[model samples]
Target: MRQPMIDTYEEAIEAVRACGILPLAPLIPDHPSLSGITLPERWHSDTELDPWRWRVRFPGDGIAAYGKFMKKKAILVASDLVPSVRSLLGSSRSIAQRYGDGLISKAAKEVYAIIEEEQGIETRALRAAAGMKAKESKKEFDQALAELQSGFDIVISGVRAPRNEAGEVNGWNSTCFETVEHWMEGAGIPLAPMSADEARSRLQARLGEHSSPQAMAYFAKVFGF
Candidate 1:
């Protein structure tokens, strides 16, 4: 079946608002996605209409969040629904609590501390600041980042290239990371505390209305609702 087409930012945002959650790729069942709805030529056009670029812009626009929050895939979640989503699948517990409780790894704690202190940072710089710069730490660093994103402790804010000492661009553009709370605050949204069960019920209700039974079942398992 043909997916509904979306060529511009406005149209895509409208579709996403209607659906609430959109995968960056074509992974979601019975739903529109950024890549799925967009034409292939538009992937990295280096223009305002690029879907690839939109992933970074969307979060800063204060309308939604862009992160690998579900199934370890990039997804854009509606701004208002984030608190609920985090409540259901993410930890509201502090890094200290989660680390102490053995819910997150030592590397995860080290990485998150830098993120919390800096408010946001690039992946390469974050690795350095967290003191995980050794070649062997690459895999563990990545896993820590993924773990934090999966737990909604952090999110990708945007894309940018770091600078060299001489003030020139250092390398290729990299994704920026920020605490979910900071991201929400920057967007003027609050990361309110809530009941996980309540969040699940609300999310299930919303998904049930907009998605199929089969999709709902799939989400229930994937997101652990």
Candidate 2:
């Protein structure tokens, strides 16, 4: 992919939303090579201002954005906004897919979780798939982490969650799981029709624990086990 350029935060936000990806720009120390880049001087002097910290917006229909910051220059991300930006670029393909699988798996394990919680089948399935996808996503995430040859530091805030019409907890609004699920489904992975026994075994194996009671109820409602 080509390096994306933006003159302002708003432009970056718009671009990421359009592409169904999050935009992250963390601030780091100014390098000798960055002497001529046109950025605010305070970005170099202000401890609170991380030039590497960038705004991350989900695709259209998402509710919130995530802001990520790194102390070091990212190597995987390629951008003039910050040297070593190349290292910070991470993809959610596998993680998202894993989450989708997990959601389905968990729902199958405890059908009651879905029933009591009134959670939708699509929602539970997606979460499970994301967990499964993370296994692969982490591999790529690690690669991005290692590619950073030099800089300050890195911190992943958390997954971005969106809100419903009443401001209640809704589905994930980020591309992390969504992107992975899209690919998995496109590749012909079945995320539905999982059985309780199968779901429980897979959930226990993957999570190292049994499914939660609430999760079970939600699954019951969605999967009808």
Top candidate when judged by lDDT against the true structure = 1
Candidate topping TM-score: 1
lDDT of 1 by residue, 163-220 (tens): 9889999778988989998999899887678897888877777766677666677778
* Error at 156, model 1, angstroms: 0.5
Per-candidate TM-scores read 0.93, 0.21
Q: What is the lDDT, from 0 to 100, of the residue 105 in candidate 1?
A: 98
* Model 1, position 32: C-alpha lDDT score: 64
Per-residue lDDT of candidate 2, residues 12-90 (tens digit): 4444433222223322222111112225563435233323333221212222222232233321121111111212232
Query: Where's the lowest-lDDT run of ten residues in candidate 1?
Result: 206-215
Cα distance off (Å), candidate 1, residue 184: 1.1
